[model samples]
Target: MPYLTTADGAEIFYKDWGTGQPIIFSHGWPLNSDAWDVEMKLAADNGFRAIAHDRRGHGRSTSTYTGNDMDTYAADLAALVDALNLTDIILVGHSTGGGEVVRFAAQHGAGRVVKIATAGAVPPVMVKSDTNPEGTPIEVFDSIRAGVLADRSQFYQDLSAQFFGTNREGSTISQGQRDQFWRQGMQVGLAAAYDCVKAFSETDFTEDLKALDVPIFIAQGADDQIVPIDDAAMKSINLVKNGTLKVYPGAPHGIAGSYQQELDKDLLEFWLS
Candidate 1:
């Protein structure tokens, strides 16, 4: 039970394994660090130090009613990095975790980070606006907020299907996978989960992406249902100074589970490169 207390008094639980160049993992919304077990194991087995934190208000961390926004999320992450005294780090994030990583790199990750990788990540921006016409509409996020308030348990269970693309024809996603997703989502605090919807959807990362000087690897599912590739990774690649884009054909938003092997191969290459 490794925990770090942030400036805002939120306790963040983290997992640290193996010992080499550090690879820190940030998970998506409504899910904990357990979501990164497979990848963390891979990184550890490959002679890298694997680290992942249950974001504040999610999983085993303190579920504070306040500071559920992206800025706080980044600050919590900075606290973890500082506590560990890690350098030359490889930061990997999935979905909302992607947003956290981007913001952290822009704000707190000056000389500490060496490389970054994001899969099924939400970045650049997710919500629609005049400047970003391809983004998802605000109504969609409002519906998500409504769903969270009305019946969150059922909402998470239903969202697991879309997150993994199990609702699609010929999809190979398993029942257990969907069940794990639901389980993870259910562990999130109601307040954090609710506020995070607005955080992930509305926070613009255009400037954050532009601030990165390290090599960035952006992986996206061609058929992501939650965060569309067109609005996220595709556009994110152009914003970073050094960026590589890898799109998984017919992959879903939960590429970490649905397309694990493919993502592992690509990430390994990027990390070693």
Candidate 2:
């Protein structure tokens, strides 16, 4: 298995493929690089390099229960880019990964970043602090953290329903798709999942989003439950200087699988333009 050792000596598992301008993807909480298979293949076929890393403690990467915060996540990404010498890269992040991209772009500067997009991202902050009034309540995330640490398997299964919006009545679903998502969630470490619940929920990306003067796209599924579509992606676009917004009606948080073709077309045309 291929791996890149971060500065802190944690081995980060990653997939790097094809050749051309790079498209680096960061997966959401509790999942690995495996989250972007469809999108990665499309980018590879479309004449670009695609790279994705399983954040430390997730997937086949080192499962050490340390340094699982957003700063470390972005730092690990920086190490990966520096080690690979990738430039003009498009950073695509979903959920918590979106927070990582914003921090990485701001902390490292956007010279290496050609473009950025956050899907179901946790940006402009997710938690309702005194500073940001309209954010999600901390108690809601605390309940999630408790649920994950208590019964991971059951929690993952229940989460599957929310991610795909299968919890709703009369929504047809693929059993295989649900099973795959459950398997991915189970593959991640419980401690990592538990810690990152708070990590993603509390990360404040307002300054990071404001600092970037580059083109940004915030795509969200209006019906997202795990991470509300409005606060995560929609609010992010409003904060950035040059930002494009796209909303998928009635789509769930895992819109990558549900709307892959549409997203692929968006990326291809966005890159070409």
Candidate 3:
């Protein structure tokens, strides 16, 4: 198993495939790098070096109790990029992974990154504030923490439906899709997973988005229930100096699985462009 050990002693398991321009993938909350398998394969098949790592404390990586915050997450990502000695990278992130991508670029990417793409990502902050009146209420995140503490298994099962929009009308998500989400969520460490709810829900990425100078492709599911398009992708597009927004009319938060082909092609085109 290929792994990169962070400065803080976290072992980040990664998958590196194909050989060409590097495309690094970051996954969402409570899920592992396996979540990006389809997209990674698509990149690899198209003559790109696809790389994805299980974030610290998720999937096969070290599940440390400390350093579950966004800054730490970004630093862990920097460790991976430095360890691989990658340059001119194309970063792709989904959901919380999107937050990680922007944060990493803002703090560490510099000349290393060429382009970025995010799908159904959480960015520019998700929690409501006096200034950001349209954001999701903090109480909603409190409830998520409550659910994680009360019964995480049931919580993940129910969240999976919303994550993939299976609970929505006309959704074509399969039982396997929901099951895989639950399986991935369950694999995460309890402490890390619990701490991450706050990290993904409250961490402000407004400054991070503004710092990006590379071409950014923001893809959103118009009907995304997990991270509403308005609060996330819609707001994110405007913050990036060089950005392109692609809205999928009825897609859900888990667009990578539910709308795989469309996203894969769009990402490939963006990279080639």
Candidate 4:
């Protein structure tokens, strides 16, 4: 129930706990702050202040249908930073949340950020434009957007399988895993999620990635179907002034959660280094 109101009077729900350099997490489309718990708790145990916010319409936050664009997302995040007066934050984002990290850093600068990282992020543009000719096709995003509008629940359900899933974990799929994913999506405002489809798919963040002045890392699942390593992580590495890429072979899009121990270890090393 804890939430902070943004500059535009939007009530942004967030979890701010623990102590040390703040680690702010931005989650992917349709999912909320709960997505970052494993990472947040680990950081907290290691003496870091970990925070995660539910994008306006998702999770327990107010489910307003407006302000679902990338700029608004960045602004909402900035408001949380300002409200907490967070200093020395390490911003970590996944999927669409990755784009949020990039846009937030570029718009607000790293006034209190020591590092920024993206995991299976959607950046450097997701859908191919003239400048990014190698990007994902327009029809791909259009089809996804259409699918969401057509049947929000079913589309999200199918997407959960496509996104969180990869055979690398195992050939067999677990019902618990599938149910957990479904629960996360069902906890949000359907309308907000529908609009977010386009925001995440089409938002361009080339300048944002390039302008990052702080240390940045990108961990991408090589076999991820949702956001290809080449389109998001590799491209980000090439753009950021000081950036590194970590490729997780045969991992799923939800590698951040599925492969927590491995990722946490890698991240801690990076943080201390």
Question: How would you encode candidate 1's per-residue C-alpha lDDT over 1-273 as one tens digit per residue?
Answer: 889988878889999999999999999988999999988998999999999999988999998899999999999999889899999999999999999999999999999999999998889999999998999999999999999899999999999889989889988888898888889888889999999999999999999999999999999889899999999998999999999899999899895454888899888888778
Q: Candidate 4's C-alpha lDDT?
A: 0.83
Specify the highest-lDDT model's number. Answer: 1
Residue runs of model 3 more than 4 Å from their true location after superposition: 256-258
RMSD of 3: 1.0
Q: Model 3: per-residue lDDT, tens digit, 132-163?
A: 89999999999988888899999999998888
Worst 10 residues of 3 by lDDT: 255-264
- Comparing 2 and 4 by TM-score, which wins? 2
Candidate 2 vs. truth: CA RMSD? 1.4
Against the true structure, what is each candidate's TM-score?
0.98, 0.96, 0.98, 0.94
Candidate number with the higher TM-score (2 or 3):
3
Q: Please, what are the lDDT tens digits per residue for candidate 4 over residues 98-124? A: 999889989984677779888889998
* Candidate 2, residue 37: lDDT: 89
For residue 68, what is the lDDT in candidate 4?
A: 90
Q: Which model, 1 or 3, shows the larger lDDT?
A: 1
In model 2, where do residues sit more than 4 Å from their true spots?
Answer: 256-258
How close to the true structure is residue 249 of candidate 2, measured as C-alpha lDDT?
Answer: 76
